[model samples]
Target: MSAQFELPRDGVTRIMAAPPRLNLRRAASYQNDKGPLSSTSSRFNFNHLVFSPPPSPGLPPPLVTRPRKLSNAPRPSRVFRFVFWVASLVAFLYVASLFARRFVGHVPSVMSWAIESQDEYEMVGQDELPDFPTPIAVTDVHGRSKWTVSIPPTHTFPLSVQEYADMCAQCHEVAVHVRELHGESTSKQQARASYYYRDPYFVDVGEAESHGLLPGFSKTSKATGRSLAKPLIGESWDYMVEKPACKTSLTFVLESADGGLGTTLMLLWMAYGLAQKEGRAFFIDDTRWAYGRYTEMFQPPPPADCVPPPRHEMLPCPHGARHLVVSAGTARDTFGPAFTAQFEDVRQDSIERERPLFNLARVGYEALFRINKDDRPYVMERIEELKLKTTHGTNGDAANSTIIGVHVRHGDVHPVEYQYNGAYIPLTIYKERIQQAAVAQHNRAMPESVEPAPAPLVVLASDDPRVFESEEFSGVIRAQERIKLAGKVPVVQPVLDKSVMHPFKEEAVGWEGGFFRVMFWNLGRPSIASKQTQISLAPEATKLRAFIGRAYVMDLAVLGATSDVMVCTISAMGCRLLAVMMGWEKAMVKEQWVNIDGDYSWVAL
Candidate 1:
């Protein structure tokens, strides 16, 4: 069917047509005139209605209105178009991000089965401390591992200082062949016999001063100084690889086994000391070390890429073995009066006992660790932030402020971990020592006049955070709480209480790794008393415990590198680490450090 109509304003002819239907029941189908519109709608009616309705003759003409404007687009389809553009934009951003990271010197983020990033497995390191520069958090240890480097026969290299001096005269090519390599000189790169060993046999207190064992007050104790260790740490990359390169190498490794975080650090420290003593290239094989990659957690060993010879040649005992491998398994066998300890001869003499080849180990540890630029500022920034929070008097101003570092041991540390027989010391002991040290520091900073001293700032770190709750620390910033100004002096904690540390309650048994375990295996089996009752985290607890380890690392750095007085128990290896890390001056020169437990001294591991 078809239809035509005339315009309302002008008379016009109109026509209509209808097709014949095969059956009457089909009836007449009709339609209306059409025009372009956003939405199309046609009337379906009987032809009879269109033919009969001329709209009542007398009725006022229906008011004409402009066609309703409409859209042809469907609601669902428009929504779909918007969604596609959004998805495309997101994909573009992701690709651009990948390129941007690489442009900034970052390698593509690696994915691994052993290590996968999970939201719940929070990052333990600070935003500034990348998981890079080596020492991964937690991974298995490599045992009986074969390496690619070839071993050298330098077994006779480290005999004695006299012999070593002669060897250096011949092998190292020093400018002047002095009879004693012990004469005073401030030049750090030059080899000094005292830099390597104190030689308990030939004891001379005055000559020891010339060895440059102490990084001068100019470097370690300067007012604007940022590090207490950088001056102590001296490494000659060229010296290690000059002519013969690695004359010898020390491999500090685990027997394809894991170790406790604290014990492993101490082991590496001892190994580095021995390596420096022998002028051996120090190499760390924390390959399967429980804490991730070696470089991930720490700066690489000096003479950075110097790989060790094959594992088969690495011997356990007899210190000067060409390739000495030191592990907890062989410490007793290897360190048998080799050095760094008071020999049986010194046991009777009080003076000898007091000075047990301290510089020997001091040389080693000083050469052991040096802080990086990224981490150098954590303590400094926090200290400045704290000083701003504090109200320092002129005598106790930040410029001359005595920054005190205190490490309190509790939780799983004290009695069980190291087999300590004495009861834990009173917190009051720390208070008294801190008070005493403050007065001493005040005296050191003040002139002979009678002016009030400035208040001291204390940096407190602990295995247990609850100690901060005691009355002695009331005005301090609690690890887990908001910082509030409460006292004249303020104590700052390494980490918030919960995001990282918690007092270790006696939990399920799971401590089955380390040299102790290797020894237990060698001595038949561990007795019931030897078994550990401490809590062992579940396999998935990696994310939970990682940050706490990082906080511990920062604590050591801040305490040893920045603080003026250190107060901690020497029984724990960690506390002893502070002794060595603080440089010999703190123990010898001014004696600013304090070992709260009167029973223990800064005994070398």
Candidate 2:
């Protein structure tokens, strides 16, 4: 037996005899009133409750309660899920398609679309095109299309100075007639006649005199007799002073043999110098021979007529007045003392050289042909008009901005008779030279400031279109990194079209690759005396010539507007003419030469 003791009711201590060990199988078989511990088990108990025991000291505390289970919400059906996934996929595809359509497909820009639409509409016209006829296909000597030339419809020549004035008069007359017949206002008449031609501003003689632009007169004529003259406003006749005694007229006769445009311009300059020195009105007569023919090609201004009564129909030498007949060979000596008192002789026969005239050591070239301040406005206006009429593409920015002009002579120069025969300059040389010039010009034009300098624009005038195909030329257009220009440089050139009339193979025999062939088409047979023969061209030749001339003039204007740095080929007379027009110093103009090996180098002209 085992001893047993009982304590008071509040606390108990008991000893009892040890019972037999309970059967392990029977203990395991015991079950609680509640079923197995599961999510459905209740926390409340019917009998006395038992608490959990403490965890062992070395182990983590045991959990007091089982974890709450997540709610069994019903899952979506398979069909619904499939439909939802398909709809999501379709939405994603639709969005991707829209994005691709907006940005990835063959979508054209608004400008491009508009241009294309315009071109299509133009092609849909039924009647034959005006000004430009069907291109006359011609085969070259090699029977290849590459060298083939196309002749376009003929056009009329440019209006001469007299012809232009007459046309203006006719327009005014027509407008007046229309107004009288229809009782229209003067403004309406002007509007109706506006398309015919532009009337240049009349230069005021008084203003010219105030600016010291009028020529001076040192001597008087010997004739002292009365003469009959027409009334100022009407056709009535009146008696006037006979053969006014004043050395007020100077006439310059350009030689027929001087065919080059540059030579002609030099002669004009010489005549201008003499007139300015002697204070005499000047006249240029280029209407007789070779130079005359060339002169006729352009529509130059008429002789200045500012004299009072007894006005001669054409500019004429004063009666009984000593004449100064100067040739190209004696120009230097003749003009040397022209501005000084040493040139007192009334009659001086001076000759000039075949080259451009330069001033003596004292007078600078700029001072020699310096344009009067009054003439600047006219020149600028003329240039603006020419640019608007001639430039094919958008050259608005270039016309107003800093531009470096490059004149390349490669067409007629290929002929042995040409001054620069066998001289072919590679495109790289031009590119390098242009780059250097651009850099220099930029540096000179840039102000000492923190802002980056504006890159200069390049205007390329060349006889051959192949120059554009060169890596160097294209690189400039694309503004490649390899070019050493301080800033990106852009290049502009005239676009030549096939519809325009061009010279035939026979007409361009010597100058097969020249701009003349593209600009003028010879329609008649070659004359015996090539120099004396008049160039008979297709009706369209005149229009083309005028267009090309205007374009060339605009190019020069652009160059002149630059920062006084010009890079040009030595053989390119056009470039020299532009330099002279711009009043550029000899040091400012750079001449490029081509060696026998087709290499290019530069020197001051």
Candidate 3:
């Protein structure tokens, strides 16, 4: 018997055989065991685990994602957002309006346009435009409507003492009001009153005529006793009425070696007086030597009624008329014999020793020099333009600031070698003068109890650039510093570039081969490379003239717009002209000074 085998399942016994023959039932059972398991819950096992197959080499890796958290913050309200936006818009508009107002304030209106429309808007004549307050309807003593006319500022000449005092009160409140409050105790007020009396404005027209304070006036003449209201010779009304006929012509030549703008103006006024007295058409011949450089810088309005002679015409007089050639520097007796003879006759019998002829010329000069209405607009425009051009920076604050004009004239004035060299003024002298002037001006502008005025900016004008190159320029700066140390605000001097000197070129040539060339060539030696006086050949005179002429005009315009005192060389014609234009006559220094002649005393015209 073969070895017996026991089965533990149910106590079954089986004999081990070499191999049980292959049965179909056994093969079927083996195949069933390899089949897939059921996915239903009934066949699932909780503890059983299964493994997944590896991924293919070419595939992408699996993606992992993070969970997000939800926010609970509250959003802004609609009303709050709307209110915020409205506030921002209002702020933007307010800022914009401020800028608009500033722009409107800065831009000057076109005065020409306003003047042109005067006829349409109002039925007033140019002469009827009120300078001072006047009634709408003017009447005589009888209460009947007389002609309604306005007296212009220019017509204030020959004003009475009372009228002058009234005008002074209007123009200068501090001078008049302060003195009146103090019972006129200040010496300054007395000095100013004396000056006012001497001014042409305060002269009594009737008294002046009776005293024979005019040319061609005989003391015994019946006309001298006429009423003051009636028009008189040398007056504007008389000048207008007695102008020469169109056919008659007269020429006046002004000849002088050292006469500048002031002297030339005085001479021109004398010529005008003679022309009016003789009833002859007048013209000025300045071709030989003239202030052409200054005159040409501005395009002054043409004379209202007269056609002046052409600039290029050397002979302005009519073909047959005799020319009256007068040397401005000649003795009074020989200056104009025909006119002088009448004064001599009056002087012989006059009780007052004062020279009436001199007073007549002075009065005429003031009248002729009054700026005309037509020229006013041009002057305003030029002043604005120059104020912009001369000042630095884009904001243009300097243009509006108070300007203290300092004009130092040097070069070719007189005594080039020694005693009176124009450029010989010491820096210390200029500093002291400027400081004193500034202080006086400050005191005059404000009341005693009030704070001082804002410090004025100093504007330098000089014929010789060397005047500025001197230590005096820096000395002026130090003077400003001294003002600050004295508890006042400090001022700064403008930094002017050298290029401002040249703005035009001279082209015209005359008997003198161009006024600039002849005048400057005698000033100093010429330099070849610089093309300026003392720096070039005589042919370059045109360039030199252009440079100096433009600079001179620029200086005048700058000085004209200044608001405060002007410290200047007393003998300089430029200083006098500036004082007249800017109405700063009282501020000028009255120190003892000399001219080209070694005469210790000299007075500007």
Candidate 4:
């Protein structure tokens, strides 16, 4: 309907229309002005508030004031920035240091495994004490399944001309078999036959006068300006025999233990190293003791990637090849499958095994050439030949208690799912197997003893059921049981201290497949019993452990810092050997699942 309209007077205005009729009971609706301000205030009524009219002529515009500038405010200092940068750098380094440490720490263990996984598993060959003098620590045996104790010292004679000659004759005496090898060349065989004879196994009496081409010492005894002419028939040949509280320490004391002089020397060297330097490499005064000339003579030989053997052949390390990791296997493989297959049977044959004699005949020669790098070529060539021979397999005589082995079996390589899968075998089963082997060896007259067994075998596996169960997966027991069965062990015993288990837990989430490796320690012919144990780790842990195994690879020049990422701190020489061994293993080495960020990659030992 038409209505009257009125308008406001200010520049901003609005019109009003009057309605003819009103419905008091109905809700009222009103429209607002069609301006920007009105639209912006659509939800608010600008006219709703009543205010007193501005004073008479509008009070003077509210007093205005300029705000002060904030440019003069205090700021952080340069020193603070510098300190921050330094702290950041340190933190970065600290983290990197941790990463490096994690990488390098795995090396020794991996190296140990590699060495123990060879065909000689329990029987590391007899190192020539005279030709190769560096001491090495052999991993103690695990799983008390057999009894072949290391022999005791055979003699402790005074270091004298006659005593020396007699001692030398014992080791140098040639057997008919060795004589046959020499065949027609009496001169050549003379050297071979006399090699062990000219010097006594324990006394250096003959060495002072007979060995050729070595440094000479002109000693003026402190008491007299003359040479120390007479042989002192005292204990400990290097030093004058000393009588402690009870008895005189003998000259040329015979080392009577599992490792003999080699181990003792290494321990001494290590102890000396630790005592002298915080982070320095191991060293010794070569000029002071019997090892002086030996170190100079046994320096490592040059690197040699020998020609591959014919399809059917195999070879092993020469007697003194340094940085060596020997394996016995078939032509198609790099480790001994035949030896592994015989593990079970060896126990059966041990019943009538003969006792072995302990000998340190090689010690003097080892001391003579210990670090001399010149003999390396011949040593390497011989080593290559040995490797090839071992690959082709050896006859029954090769089987002896002195030969201890660990069989690392790779899992079946079919069906991708199975490849990632792990099996569990109870520790009891392994123990039983060891017991059975011991029984068999005893039955065979191999000198087995009936002692209540202690832990002797260390089993390493990629898929350990125990670890999987910890992740809270369902039915872990079933999985663990399955693995135990596959492992061929029935008793479920944990070898490591329980405290170390959680932190060192090994799992197999990424183990592509499982493979078998064996480590051997030959204790002079048939003296095989020493400490033994088996450890099983899952795939991820296996890689770490395998890195430790890499140390046994003997070619240092070839083995550099390829595994720099795998380790944080290790002696430079140790690093080199680790790298070389990893290189030797090639594809068999484990993949690095753990890493720093996503950039760096891990290489072979």
Top of the candidates by lDDT? 1
Predicted candidate 2 versus true structure: per-residue lDDT over 1-605, tens digit per residue:
96557677877765564432422222212324334555465633422233322333455656334333344754568678989999999999978855654445312111000013312211122222222211111112222111000111122122123322232233233324324544667775556432112222111222222222221111242112112222121112223623333345554544423323444455555555655555655444443323223333333323344422222211111111222333343333334332222333335332112113333211222322333243334446644543443233243333323345566666544423244366565667666776676555555555464543344455565555556555666622211111111212334545668899865433223323445532233323244434544555544544444434444444444455532445565556555455455442433233221222233321112
Local accuracy of candidate 4 as per-residue lDDT tens digits, 370-394: 3234434543553443334334434
The window of 10 residues in a row where model 1 has the poorest summed lDDT is 139-148
For candidate 1, the C-alpha RMSD (Å) to the true structure equals 29.8
Better of 2 and 4 by lDDT: 2
Question: Where does candidate 1 stray beyond 4 Å?
Answer: 1-247, 254-260, 304-307, 338-357, 370-380, 383-399, 415-422, 477-540, 543-545
Colliding pairs, model 3 = 527-534, 527-535, 527-536
Question: How would you order the candidates by lDDT, starting with the best?
Answer: 1, 3, 2, 4
TM-score for all predictions?
0.47, 0.37, 0.37, 0.18
Model 3 ranges off by over 4 Å: 1-250, 254-262, 273-280, 290-323, 327-402, 414-423, 450-454, 474-519, 522-540, 543-547, 582-605
Q: What order do candidates take by TM-score, descending?
A: 1, 2, 3, 4
The residue-level lDDT of candidate 1 at 72 comes to 69
lDDT: worst 10-residue window of model 3: 478-487
Counted clashes in each candidate structure: 25, 17, 3, 163
Report the C-alpha lDDT of model 3 over 67-147, residue by residue, as the tens digit: 232346545686789889999999999788556534432111101101223122122323223543211222222222212
What Cα-based lDDT does every candidate model obtain? 0.47, 0.38, 0.39, 0.25
RMSD of each candidate relative to the true structure: 29.8, 36.3, 36.2, 32.4
